[model samples]
Target: MQATKRPDFIDQQYDFAAYIRNPEHNAAPDGIETRRMAIYRDLFYNNIENFAASAFPVIRAITSDERWHAMIRDFMVKHHCKTPLFLEIAQELLDYLQNEREPQADDYPFLLELAHYEWVELALSISEESAIGEDVDPNGDLITGIPQLSPLAWPLSYHYPVHRIGPEQIPDGETETHLVVYRDRHDAVHFLEINAVTARLLQLIQQNVAASGRELLESIATEMNHPQPQQIVSVGAEILLDLRHRDLLTGIHNIPER
Candidate 1:
């Protein structure tokens, strides 16, 4: 079947947008004045670059001016963004980095992970997700009761220590870095680095949501073949309390006593 032709107005709009997004590659539409087009070009590109700079401040700071602008230009030119909203621009950029970005010799090996870390901070700050639930008890026994992991708390493992990357130094080597990025009740975002053991414990809690905190700790001990499982339980209890204090654990799930 033959495809229907798009309206001339649609083609004109596409030409205008294409040139504005990547003026170096695409020419301005037939009759548009260069002076008028310059305003749109600067306005559109600057808006995107400013937002990208804000969303990924660490990336912006550590990256050279030419490299940073090149990256933003590539994003605008190549990545097909899905949303038109400004708040979602960070997420869109993340999508571009993860899936669409072409590899470059000058790009940091940890660029993707670093972008994700930055995006998570912005995402959690603006998130409207609620931790409030009728089935959660603020002061319930973490060990004896089923603990509710806060949706606001994210458990992430990266090959690089994304949190440590900044203007000071790029660092030397990569290792398995586990972190929990969370938004507390006060709406402040925090990045907490945890050991491998703590990471596994959180993983167990997320997977076995119905199990009591004691059961979760015991499972970890069993997995490790630790003879003194009670010690694990004791220490894990303290860790749970610490998480509660930090608002990472939304407290114990208020399942009715059988």
Candidate 2:
């Protein structure tokens, strides 16, 4: 028997392609082609594909198997995501669908919006950045005229009504929607349907751009255009306190510290 020469191509990369397609070429060191390699390959790809597909099941269910396989293959080759957790694959796919601005933009106009909507549920579900807010000496008194929003809370609005968009409810055209994705005390995911004005107010509060509770309320009232602005301010103050109680506001910090 002739000795087979080792290829120069072996490097740091795991050489998954060779392992999957040409397992005989690189047999196990024990001199037998173990069934474990095929098992591993099937599980690896299937796990990733299943995990990613689960996040966007509605989209996946509608898509043909051929399209899904092609899409996943393209993603596998093109994207070099950082996280090993299968759950994060949805995020990377969402980012690729959203931020990929090129000639191919027309190919998937609503794709970005859909992906964004899909990511909302997953984002709130698996977010490791838990609530870091602590109670002050005076819980209610600490709520001065200023309040800070939580680091984990996100207020997002999308051009497409995501909550309604599924295989069943998908309309002929895109519809706008507003969403607030936040983690509760139990670390459970919660979604809220907030109005555009409220969403904007939450956005400003989350970004720390609006310094004081008064500023947030005034901005909201001005943007929304209510009859009495000061009246809204008092109402907004109560809302801010409610948000604080919900752990939505971390604490009132200086504008510079934000």
Candidate 3:
């Protein structure tokens, strides 16, 4: 007896979906008209392409139209995004650029970093975390109290000056770029470029939430082997105050009186 054959309908559905996703590589379903298939293909691809362009405006501006379209096509065809959410599609593109896509000579070396930098603002804007809480004291003493980094605040470091990259401002050499991206109380996302020391100070606060601002500064001063620890403490206090004012530090951690 001959083996049973699978129904053509199932195969046709798979073929049609594949063609819509990648017309260049896959053929149209056997019976479907080319014109109709083209409509589906264009619709699907255009939506994704438009979303990517909007999400990574800097990347789209810097790359040639030909290259940008090719990159989007590659992402559409190659990357199997896990999330069904539209917002997450941008993140999927970033993941593809960072881990899957091979670098091309014409592509900027900071392409992935810049894409990530752009995504950060969108991500922070949609984050569910509150900027400040009832437990936080906005006017707490920086020197005596534990400083709390806001959940919406992120300290990020990149090898390239991603924040400054644009069509005409491509950096020549790699430099350590330290940035703090935060959502303020007003629900606005802000980015601040800081030196390595300030970045480290934020990291210390993040790592040791129980440490008072003065203790954190003392630790930093010890690490730096500063000749005058008091001066470091003073400067560090000012830094803490600035961060607090910027809403990067939610406020001090309130401990009950003993």
C-alpha-based local distance difference test score of model 3: 0.89
Query: Model 3 reaches what TM-score against the true structure?
Result: 0.92
lDDT of candidate 1 at residue 180, scale 0 to 100: 99
Prediction-by-prediction clash tally:
0, 0, 0
Residue 242, candidate 1: Cα error in Å is 0.7
Ten consecutive residues with minimal summed lDDT in candidate 2? 136-145
134-212: candidate 3 lDDT, tens digit per residue: 6788788978888888999999999999998888898998999999999998999999999999999999988875778
Candidates ranked, most accurate by TM-score first: 1, 3, 2
Pull out the clashing pairs in model 1.
none
lDDT of 2 by residue, 1-258 (tens): 999866745431346554543344544333324576668657767877888788987678666788777677656655667787777888888766655433242233456676776787788778777466554222443224356666667777777776666666655676667776777777777777777666776777766543566777787888778889998788777767666677666657543443
RMSD values for the candidates in order, in angstroms, are 1.6, 5.9, 2.4
Return the candidate ranking by lDDT, descending. 1, 3, 2
TM-score of each: 0.95, 0.74, 0.92
lDDT of 1 by residue, 1-258 (tens): 999999988898999999988999999998879999999999999999999999999999999999999999999998888899998999999999998989899889999999999999999999999966567888999988888888899999999989998999796789899999999999999999999989998888777657899999999999999999999999999999999899988888854577
Clashing pairs in 2: none
Q: Is candidate 2 or candidate 3 better by lDDT?
A: 3
- Number of the top TM-score candidate: 1
Model 3: lDDT of residue 15: 90
